[model samples]
Target: MTSLFDPLALGDLTLKNRLIMAPLTRMRSQQPGNVPWELNAEYYAQRASAGLIISEATQIAPLGQGYPGTPGIHTGEQVAGWRQVTDAVHRAEGLIFLQLWHVGRISHSSFHPDEGLPVAPSAVKPSGEVLIADWTMAPYETPRALETVEIPEVIAEYAAAARRAKEAGFDGVEVHGANGYLLDQFLQDGSNRRTDAYGGSIENRARLLLEVVDAVVGVWGRERVGVRLSPYGTFNDMHDSDPVALFTHVLGKLSDRGIAYVHMIEPRATSAGGGDTVQEGVPCSSELFHPLFDGVFISAGGYDRDGALEAVASGRADAIAFGRAFIANPDLPERLQKNAPLNPYDRSTFYGGDARGYTDYPALG
Candidate 1:
């Protein structure tokens, strides 16, 4: 039986255990250039016991900023700032990967310079609100459609960010193609209505993601790259007409590239009351992906200790990423192994705040 504590090798890197710390956006970066600081280092270092830590979604360029305080890897100063974080994690003998992100239509105009509209594959306006700098939940704005000539520049930006992540000492980079962000906006047909080569068929929709992956791999090599996908996620008002087919095709392409791993967000049924019907977009089993991709498969979203153990033991997932659990318990792998009680996470301080809920969580003594 494969236990959660067992070591696993992801590409050229070897992880100590199967419990990975998921990329969580705490919105606590330093303001001037959205740079990471020592405080962020301390927070990640405290949780270094995990097999691998995927840093929060980091923007690849100024045009990628969706929310305030999220870190960026584009500038020299930002690269230097992240060096502190990677050094701290390394000193603690932990491996880390940076998640590259671009928000696309899941953003507001205020975050853009000159109040320019956010960009997406198409000019579709998603139905929902976005969390901005001041903690205000503002209505979504219709994003400007990207011109075909400009697509290569965005792809190059991701490649540049991967180089910076390597310069800052990260073991690998995970492309943020999930969570209704820029890549997801293009992958799903609901938001992408472009008639050009970048849209229409599933292959066309997946083109940008594959291009970004190839670009990043060019910098870090295929073994040091990963990609995340949310097949049935409804967050940020995202829905794919055919998730299983779309993801199976996408995963097939990723397997051909021989990248490191694929992290997937599982489905959680939602309802207003006890008798209300569950939301229609339930996801297929993670086991279905095992044969499709020839690399590590990680499943996230509302996993408990026992459930995670079962998933890995049954060969459904190579690893399990704990989001909220890791937030409260810095030593989550230890806590899970001992079956120790966990510290409850404060809901209010989840997004933007000082060190109150950020680094103040006490690990088991």
Candidate 2:
């Protein structure tokens, strides 16, 4: 049986174990430039024991940002800032991947360049409120539909971001296509109501994501690129008429591309209460979609040690990504290896905070 501690070949890199630190949005980047700083470096370096540490979701361009203090890969300063983080993780003997992201309609105009409206595949308005630059909750506004000609610009941004990640000293890059973000909005039918080549059918709907993947792969090659997806996610008021069909095609295409891995969020994680709240009887996205992808399969959700062990041992998932658990336990892999009790995480400081909930968690002595 494969244990969580077992080493696994993941693309060009071999993970020392199957415990991955999921890309968590902490919104703590330095202001004015959304650049990562020394504090961010310390937070990631503290959790360097994981098999792989996927950095917080980083916007590929200024327009890609949706929340305050989130880091970006677009500017020279941002790249330099992330270099500090990558250097720290490497010095700690850890491998890390930067997750390239675009929030689309999940954003408010205040975060946009010149306060422009958020862009999406359609002009639909999402149901929830978004966190703006001032840390206030504002209702989501109807986003501007991207002109068909404008999409190539978006694809180019992803490629540019991948190159920036490389320059920043990351081992690889993961395209953020999950959790009702920009790519997710394009994938599902509820948010993407377009008549052009970018939407309408399953193939068309997945076109942008695949194109972004191709662009990123061009920069990092197939072995160093991965894509994250959330099939049954309802967060940000996202839905699909036929999720299985949509993701089956998406996963199959990604598999055919022979990329590094496909990270998926289990349906339970996007349940009504919260991402960490587990809903009973929800199907595991990895179990349903892992077989569709030929590369490394990583599953993220509300997973305990026993559940993670079973998922890997049973071959349902190749590795497991932990979010909230990793937030509260920097030495999570060591603690799990010894079955030690985990420190409870504070929800209040999960976002837009200082070192309190970010790096203040004590490791096992």
Candidate 3:
């Protein structure tokens, strides 16, 4: 039987342990474009002790951006900034994966090109809110529906971004197809209404996300790729009547991809924003998300050591991911192994800030 600190092989990437650093958006990048900076290098390096670290969600294109201070992989400067971060982690023997993200309509027009409305699968408006900048909470901009001709462009953009992530020094990339983003919007009928080949049927709606995975796999090969999904999450005004049916069909498509792993956030778990919302017009529980994917599964949300052990022992997941714990405990793997007390994360400085709630967290002595 494998233990929490057991050596694990995630395709071409071999890890010293199975405790993964769940992708958390701290929004520490530069403004106007979310370009990375020296401070980001320091933040990631401090947490380099993890077996694997999935860096924060990075926008694949300008219109894909949602919140301020999040990183982007579209430009030369951003790539250069991330190179330093990757180099720092590598020097400490840490393997990192960059998450490719498209926030869809979970954005404000203020952050877009010419301050225009953000785009989504359809023109439908979603309930709920998002934090923009310091002291700014706005209603998600009413999104404009994408034309059929524009679908392939977004797919290609994700491919280009995956190439950029490789060029930027990441060992691999994770496609962000969850948490009510563009991909999830397409997967769920509540936020999508298209008569084209890209909507209506499960296979049609799953087209965009699978295309994204295929394109990234083409660039990075299946072994160096991964995908993140929140089947039970009701985030960003997202919902699906039959999530199990949707993912079961989708996961069947990924069965032969030879990808590294599938990282899942349980639906009813307390998300970064708070509790799970799988009600009417809300996304359902993610606790039963394990059977969707065929490869290695990494489960996350509200897990401690005992819980993680149980999941692995029960054959539910290959690994466990922690968000807040990683923020407050950079040496999380070490702390877990030693049975040491862990620090708490400060919620105030989670997005857009200096080093206070970032690198200042101490390790166990």
Candidate 4:
């Protein structure tokens, strides 16, 4: 049986451990430009012991911005800024991947140009609020539906963002298709009520996500591309009546593409923002859909050391990605190896904060 401490091959790269760092949005990037800076570099460098680090959900364009201070990869300055982060991680012998994101309808007009409404697959207002600058909360605005012809443009944007991730010195790119983001909006039925080629049936709903994966693969090839999905997640007010069928079909399509891996959120992840919305008795774990895909599978959400070890040992997942544990324990893998006590994370400073809960969390001595 493969232990969490053993190295595993993830596409073209080999991770030293199976404790991958899930993408976490700290909202500490530089203002106005929304670029990663030296502080961001230090933040990631401290936790470089993970098997892999997936950078926080980074917007591909200005219109994709949902919250303030989240980083972007669409500009020369932003790419240059991320170079520092990649360099820091690489210096610690850590592999890093950037997560390409677009918030879709889970956004406010304040972050938009001319205060325009955010765009989505359809005009649906999510039942939640978004954080702007300085941790200010605002209700979500009804988003403008994207025109059919403009779909190709958004696909191209993902391709461009993938190229920029390479330019920023990342080892790979994970398309953020989870957490009710743009691609998830198109993937789920609740947010997507369109009559075009991009909605209605399971195949249509999955069209945008596959197109995005294809577009990014065109730039980075299949080996350096991965995708994240939340099959039973209700975050940002997202839901699909037949999540198992929907995700199985989508994962099957991704298998044909030969992507590096599929990072899936567990059903327990649905409690975010409000309460659980996943139907009872539903098969939502990644283990149920493992055979449908031909690549590595990463299971995330509320995983502890024993749980993570069991998942990999039982062949349920090839790896496990930890979120909050990683936030408080920079040397998470090391601490887990010895079963050492972990530092508690301050929830108040989770978003839009300085180095307090961002980088000052000390690793186990």
Candidate 5:
């Protein structure tokens, strides 16, 4: 039996186990630039027991900032701040990857640098709400659409961010293409209505994501790069007319490039809540996407220990990512190794908060 604790070689890095720390969006950073701090370092270091840690979604540039207090990697301060995190995690014998993010239209003027309009593939308003700096709930605002000429710059930002992540001491970098972000915004036809080199066709719509992969892989090498994609999802008003085709074409692209891994959200994974496989919003079906990606596959969303085991046992996935469960249980692999019960996460503190729910969750003796 291939246990979750088995060492697995994912590209250049060999993980101690299969339990991956999902890239969560915890809007906790210093203001002005949302630069990372010592606290961020401590939080990540504490969770170092996980086989691999994908740090919280960090904005690539100033325009990429979606929420206040979320970290940024576009500058020197943030990179220096993150070095502490990587150093700390390494000290604890952990492998960590940085998740580069751009929220696209899932933003409010309150979160923007100039408080002007936010950007997306189109000016679509997100269906649900968003939490701001004060941790106040508010409706999402309509965002300005990105012009065709502006796309190359965005792709360059992802590449530059990946370079910064590597310079900042990250083991690898995962492109945040999932959860209704900029890449998902374009992949999903419901929001992306562009009629340019970057839209209308699946190949065209996939241009940015591919370009991003090219750029990041160029800097970090294919062995140190990964990408996340969420199909059939409803978050941030994202849905594609034919997600399978869009991603299958993408699968061919990923195949050609030799990316380190593809961290995909399975049919029932959510960005929030414990990884328990909840069926909601088209269920993010991955049956169509699985066959396409021929790399180290790490599936997350909603998966408990047993479900994760099933995924690997059935030969469907190589590894599994645990979000909330890993959040509450720092020594998650050890707990699962010993078949210990996990501590329940406090939902109220899932967003912006201190160490209470962030790092205060105890590791069993």
Candidate 6:
């Protein structure tokens, strides 16, 4: 039986264990530039025991930003800021990957350059409120559909961000195509109602994501690039007429590309008031799509130690990613290894806060 603690080959690097730190948006970057600072460095360094730490969702360009204080990889200052984080993680003997992201229709105009409307594959308004630059709730506005010619610009932005991640000294990059964000908005039929080559059929809808993946792979070879997907995700009101068909095609395409790994968000994570419960009768991404992906497969969302062990041992997933658990337990791997009780995380300081909840979680003595 494969143990979660066993070393596994993930692309060119051998992860010491299969416990990955999922990319979490803390929204604590410095204002004005949205650059990561020393505080962010300390937070990541404290979790160095994770097999791999996927940094918070980072916008690829100014227009790509959706939330206040989320970091970016587009500017020199942003790159420099991330360098501090990468350096600290490396000094702590940890490997980290920057998750390249762009939240399309998830944004309010205040976060866009020139206060322009957020862009998506179609002019659809999501059914939720977004946190604007001022941290106020604003209803999602109908986003501008991207001109066919404008898509190349989006692909280029991803490539550029991958290069910046490399310059920032990250070991690799994970394209953020999950959570009903820009790429997810393009993947599902409910949000992407386009007549052009970028939408319509499954192949067309998946075009942007694959193209973005290829572009990032160009910067960092296939071994160093991974993609995150949320097949049955309901967050941000995402849905599809045929999720299995859409994700099957997407997974098969990714397997053919031979990328490093595919990280998937289990449906249970998006459930109301989030917990470890899997929605009854909904097939898990690992159970449904794991066999389709030839390379490494990582499953995230609501996994306890026993469940993680079962998934890995049964070949349901190659690894498990922990989000909230890692927040309150910096030495989560060690704690799990010994079955030590985990410190409960404070929900109040989850987003945009100081060192109190960020780095104050005491490790096992």
TM-score of each: 0.95, 0.98, 0.94, 0.96, 0.94, 0.98
Candidate 5: which stretches are off by over 4 Å?
113-115, 270-277, 280-286
User: Could you give me the TM-score of model 6 versus the true structure?
Assistant: 0.98
TM-score of 3: 0.94
Among these predicted structures, which one has the highest lDDT? 2
lDDT ranking from best to worst? 2, 6, 4, 1, 3, 5
Clashing pairs in 4: none
User: What stretches of model 4 exceed 4 Å from their correct place?
Assistant: 272-282
Q: Cα RMSDs of all predictions?
A: 2.8, 1.1, 2.6, 2.0, 2.0, 1.3
Better of 1 and 2 by lDDT: 2
> What lDDT score is found at residue 270 in candidate 1?
18
Superposition error at 71 for model 5 (Å): 0.8
| lDDT of candidate 2 over 262-353, digit per residue (tens) | 99988888852255568879767887898889999999888999999999999999999999999999999999999999999988888887
Candidate 6: residue 122 lDDT (0-100): 97
**Which residue pairs in candidate 2 collide?**
none
lDDT of 3 by residue, 1-365 (tens): 67878878898878889899999898889765578888888888888888799999999988888878889999988998899999999988899999999988886776765848888889988887767655388776689999999988999999999989999999999999888889989998888898898899999999899998999999999998888888867767777888788888777787667688888886646354454332233333334656656677888777788988777777788888888889889899999999899897777877767989998999887
Give a tens-digit lDDT track for model 4, residues 1-365: 98888898988889999999999988899877998999999999999999999999999988888888899999999999999999999999999999999988877777765848999999999986778644688888889999999999999999999999999999999999999999999999999999999999999999999999999999999999999988888778888888888998999999999999999888776654233233446455777788789999998887878989999998899999988888889999999999999887777887787999988888876
Give lDDT tens digits, candidate 1, residues 26-52.
889998789999999999999999999
Task: For each candidate in the order shown, give its overall lDDT on alpha carbons.
Answer: 0.88, 0.93, 0.83, 0.89, 0.83, 0.92
Lowest lDDT sum, 10 consecutive residues, model 3, at 276-285
lDDT of 1: 0.88
**Where is the poorest 10-residue window by lDDT in model 1?**
269-278
Residue 228 shift from truth in candidate 2, angstroms: 0.3
Over 4 Å off in model 6, which ranges? 113-115, 271-278
Clash pairs, candidate 3, are: 232-267, 267-286
The residue pairs that clash in candidate 1, if any, are none
